[model samples]
Target: MSNAKRALQTEDLTKIEVFSDPQLSPDGNFYSYVSTKANDKDDYNSQLFVQSLNGDTPVQWTFGDVKNSNLRYSPDGKKAVFQSTRSGLPQLWLLPTEGGEARQLTTFKNGASNPTWSKDGKFIFFHASLDKDDDIQNQKEASKEERQKEQEDKKKQPLIVNRLKYKSDSSGFHDNKRVQLISLNLESNTFTQLTNNDADHGFQDVSPDGKQVLFAANLNENADYELSNDLFLLDLQSKEYKKLTDGNGGYHSASFSPSGDKVVSFGDEYEYAGATLTEIYVFDLASGERTCLSKSWDMQLGDLMIGDTRMGQSETGPVWSKDESSLFFIATDYGATGLYKVSLNKELTTLYKEDNHVFGFSYDQDKEAFVLGISSATNPCDFYYLKNDGTLTKLTKSNDAFLNEVAIAEPETLSVKAEDGKEIQGWLLKPYGFTEGKKYPFVLEIHGGPHAMYGQTFFFEMQLLAAKGYVVLYTNPRGSHGYGQEFVDACRSDYGGGDYKDLMTAVDYVLENYSFIDEDRLGVTGGSYGGFMTNWIVGHTNRFKAAVTQRSISNWLSFYGVSDIGFFFNKWEHGLNLLDDPAKLWEISPLRYAENVETPLLILHGELDFRCPVEQGEQLFITLKHLRKEVEFVRFPGANHELSRSGKPAMRQERLNHICRWFEEYL
Candidate 1:
């Protein structure tokens, strides 16, 4: 037996380092970023680190095993601020750029987060959840003893749900408190509330003159049923505000141009709501004109790229260049995330394009350079600088040791035409140590977010499957981003139709092209929407020998009442409602066809997943048992819908092990 470098092990997940939130200093001489790693507690911990752009060694700024993140630089570059949990709750902490002890800034009950420096650097703006009547000064004046008593005196009672959205998968049950925008004056050490109302304020960019702030909020009297998050600009001194958006759909990530005459952001009109693609929009402040800047540029804007790394940054921007003639943002295109530059003239350019995923990026104004976190199928994320000369330079090597130790399979991009003659984007991964003449088992891996794109990024689970001698095929079928909006919305209200055909066509394309792939010994697995697809696939066809479905939706009718977004999502995606068309929900549900399933199936779910609640899995498991179908169920305790991506280290490892063991026993 020839010994190849060891295949990536599920246990190696503990060694993966996730680098995110790269912030450039005002002088563009140094960059501060956060790196998270698995700790002895079987959980992830994060710390801050900074490195000079001039080839200086990186220095670890914060110590301890706690999570420290959201690092931001002040305008003058004299000091920085971040959020930390060293005090038991996340609070603002300030550290001098010249090196000194970090000092605590705000001590609030809900804690301060998303802190940004004011233009003059005289104050900091942040957002925090507060009771409608809670006063900031009152909490600051209370003694430590009083704080302890207040905490102990509070009673633990049953949750009373009143709002249509009472619980979230991440925050659990809600307190009915609103998230308000806040500003803290550094010189006076005083706190001022910027927003006070029933609706939650989605923070956006602060004006250049520091006299006004922009944000998105749905302040309508009937916010629960409303679908619009209008953009607003609030004057700091006058306490007056004006609405910018016309309130058609949801808007987010609004950033001011350098001239402050226009604001650039991304949002959707919600004409398709669930299936609608997010587009870039520019709102002119002087003319009160709101234009869909990306209306013609159909590829979804912002990050829809998914990978196995934990605690990655969200896709947000339209950050204006120093001249304000152009905006740089993240766009999902052709199965990868790339940094794109769009001019006010509507000419687009791919400043940095490659078969890699860029989860975060920030432009350095002083140096006129860009700092990006890019990674490929075999590489974890690390910082890279796109120089003024259009050259790329690696900035960090956080995963070099683990990368050098493991043998990961590199994916080959494949394109196949669907029945409708539309091209489907896909990738084929040969088994690790693949021999040209050897026939090996293959797995069809499906991605979630019928809207989320499967791109060139390191997915540990796919690598693990390849290491175990299974060639894997994954794709961005219809209803996936990175493609044109028409291609993405084509799968809406037709979940089991064209999208299913697209996957089958991709499998057929690989089978016809790759002779080494074992056609008779095939396996399939996916989570979330992919989980729903797996369930739908098994019930509709028996081609695969085995399958694993995770956190899936089985019955749309039951989902309508149970899942977090079921009430509206069912209508928006399937064009069906429980009250209006019960038959339609059952017609599209995978559980409706469970009797046809012949593949040995494994079901996985998170117990605390409020998005696609565990009951979805329990129902399918019971139905399969009643039918005496070959099936097994595994439930992860204290895990949410993000179990595969950001769950506990042990749980995520077990999930991978379960999938591998199931396919090994059956395939």
Candidate 2:
């Protein structure tokens, strides 16, 4: 047989398995995780798996096309609880860790998630949504026929919106259902409502003693207008709770210390609103005093790296050590997310540092080891057993077979000086099967979040572009995380000013340094904030031969009202609301310069996107068409802002095809 490699295709999306949420059993002899993959049914399939440290074959715990995730272990390591959708809506399921059939636990009508076992393993606490007047105890799941009627009834009723933040990109328009807390007694097989309010409560952690539960919420009288996520401690017996943080800031991912007298969390004071760098804090439960642990740490905490393949959420910490002397957590620094530790006195130390993205981790406090979920440019993600002494051992090779059959491109790190002499970091991937002197078309990829960083994560789109013989360049420009607080805060109130210049500078550096790139055949593309930048780039300059913008923002004036967070996002980023200064908002909008666009543009948007509403794309398309400019618009039905990331499987493949077709035609 001839030895050859195949190019990574968009159809391979279903072939690549995504691994996340590695949970080490309390005994340190085993670990469990969730493996997700896009299935042939145009949806995703995620299942739970457990592996032993003694070199036992990994055992698949859950099965089917349904999603079984968020696995949590009991203190005794005899039982595990996880959320699953096998019975229709996602509900808590109990599993016998050793060996037995998994049994359904909760049947709440609105569904249940984020299961946390009580210290004594007698009760399991979870989060669920319910209407204000709806009884939360022993709520039954609605029948299929009832759900169909409910959908039809909802369509007939007019959506009455009275709040500034009513709609969300993920879950369209808001309903009367509010996220509340619930508890299940394993012995009695009974359910009880823990908290009841109009506002939503995010379940955080249960105290070690199990007498109190920790959560995050904004329960102010005017919660509709507030954005603060205050930490709360609720007495499970009395059903009473006390606010832990002042109402001025937002806090989350909180957990009670082993002693239960203190809480450690990640939060910010809304200094820059969404752009504010999240810091670590410890709250003294007795005096209600809060101490900022990472106040002087300039880097952003937690994983802020942007990628299309990661499927599940990871453990964001300050996970306390067995002795409670220090805590370990993930932090984004430079261009990568690494495992780091901070002592009570604020002395920081790096435990597992690498150029790869460490998305999820679980600490085996007894063994002083960790089960880490890591991903990189060539591999999707895999689990590893990491020792405190810096020893690393690969556990499961989720994508090794797939990697051996395909040709993948690795990115080379690059840095350049912006117009104002500020440094910007980025990466360049040369076209696969590249020849030394052959010139290839270049594509500049931008990331959203203006606050999120693009690091050494496996990006399917970037690799696909390289396979098609296009040199790809992606950068973490100003406003991106991982950089210092000053650098991240610099993009706020500036938008297209400095951030745009940083992106342009990155392109210039690549063109100047790389001989294999053809500058005249350059293309540009991005989604969300990156999409806004793509629109701005084409409008401000005619250098790019083609451009594709996905789920973008064109008009700040319209976005202020139509978007779910429009009203506040504008003021936070641009420093002015629509009412504050209409002209200022209009002046910064990309639509204002649509007539100046000369590059052929492809506008891809999800019809159901409420964050950067589909109207944002419609307005731009119409404006460019009216001006007789080169433009085309493609709308994905029933999709949302995450169309490029976790949208439907078929839609995702089609989206990639459109992007490549646009560049191939223009270049």
Candidate 3:
């Protein structure tokens, strides 16, 4: 195939679309969701669209240059409440379901997000950090002055803050003040602060009756150990709060049942030395008892999924049917992650199973139907509906026009045994217009999280590489979630050992089994922990001809003081404090072995990335340059660790283009 034709066929990365946050109307006549589309500017813009069950052109509920997300329909289905930054900072907005102008609800300088409507539809509750009273502002200014004085006193003073945690990924700099829940009265135009404590409260869900609120909070005095967030209940009538679960381990996503007699939540009781597997639990309010629903079911399919698609585990709680007889949830099992339905009486049945992953879903108990958002290695997310009799119908064809103009590669599932004889799972994508005998250059892509799993989801970077005529191989190694707690925790204190070996084994298996792979022209690249592994791989061996590391940790010694999670992560993974044993930390750092790197490398990072920090990339780039090695550095302005997922749309596109360009030039 000609290069232009090949490019047209394989360059489907720009055409891929993502859909999320599906909400079914109360009457089950309409559904609303957030659909992200790429514009002429090559930037992704999110808008809210509502459509009927009979498949019609969706009515655009929102229009603007800004992104709209987190759409939720009120109980009466007369209006919709969502969080948007269209007015600059993210705040709550109320829009009529029948199509009308949206009105701003909350006004806060810091920001407002995660808006949930009360059961009675009389008030809207949200979380915000707008407690800047006069005394608090004065204290903050005094603290800033003290820090400036300390910095001026020493020529080379280390970066230190009085806060418990130095940095967070998206929102840098930890403040001591707590995050409170506030409810806004629509009629009175007044706000009432709900929880008035110093502790942080989040993941709130209002009960069906609107008389009580279910949420997760850390009530302990020790802020350091606040990682053990637990489920709590707040009485709106009496203005009292009570703990529902013991705060021994972290708990989140507390949702109420249809009858409001029980609450369902997910968290790890104790696994992998407190890493938390995020199993499902159902709490009976009247009996004051909690039952582990996930444990009762066969775990042979693996750990249950929890949380939304953006953060936390990909698995979420089961949505209770209208009558509270059956629960529908999503899980990754039997090689693919899809939606499942579990009967409260004890029978488990698979509702809908597809080749791709189901990120988020909503069910309408009144109609006995559900609207789901599903995606796979080759297909971007799209909307679908499952009827009561098990009939599946496609709702929206958002990418039909884009997909017709671009050639896309299909991903094939591949499995290999690790060095220790454990089974590993992964997928491989061949270049568009691939031939049978011709050998093609290959790239091994690693995923971040050291705890996150790369499942059957459409990834833009992987497709972009395939379009450039490179075979893309990605896998969930030993430390990845979705398998089990023990498997994910195995990488702790052994960052460069088993995980590195598993990746190498995957590479060897592909080269040996696939005849179309070229061994001489090999490249490796990854971000975060994957980036850390790429650095480690290059330092230990010179097999790869080229490498690219994004937001990686080069030297643990420097990272201990720079990155936001440096102090805690170093201890959690290495099991050693920075002050006690700096040597062990250094040994695990990728920069310590930079002398062995001979292959050309490109380091990419975001300047505002506090999670891995730009300094980590700088350390690797500067050290490689000083050692007389070929290296290139690319820094994104005002981007954070989420640059690949939800960062600025233009920047995200540039990042993908840069990675593809580097590989095309070097390999």
> What are the models' TM-scores?
0.97, 0.98, 0.90
Better candidate by TM-score, 2 or 3: 2
Number of the top lDDT candidate: 2
Residues 1-667 of candidate 2: C-alpha lDDT, one tens digit per residue: 1126888888888799998888999889999999999876889989999999765778999999999999999999999999999988999999998899999998889899999999999999999989887776648998879989999999999999777677898888888888998888999888888888778999999998889999999999888888888998899888898888889999888898889988999999988788888899998888888888888988899999899998888885879998888899999988899999999899999999798999989998888899889999889998888987888998888998999999889889988899988789999998878888889999999999989999999999999999998999999998999889889889998999999999988898888888889989999999999999999999999999999999999999999989998988998999899999999999999999998999999999999999899999999999999999999999999999998889999999999999999999999
- Model 1 pairs in collision: none
Which residue runs does candidate 2 get wrong by more than 4 Å?
1-3
Candidates' C-alpha lDDT: 0.88, 0.90, 0.77
Model 3 clash pairs? 9-407, 305-315, 305-316, 306-315
How much does candidate 3 score in TM-score? 0.90
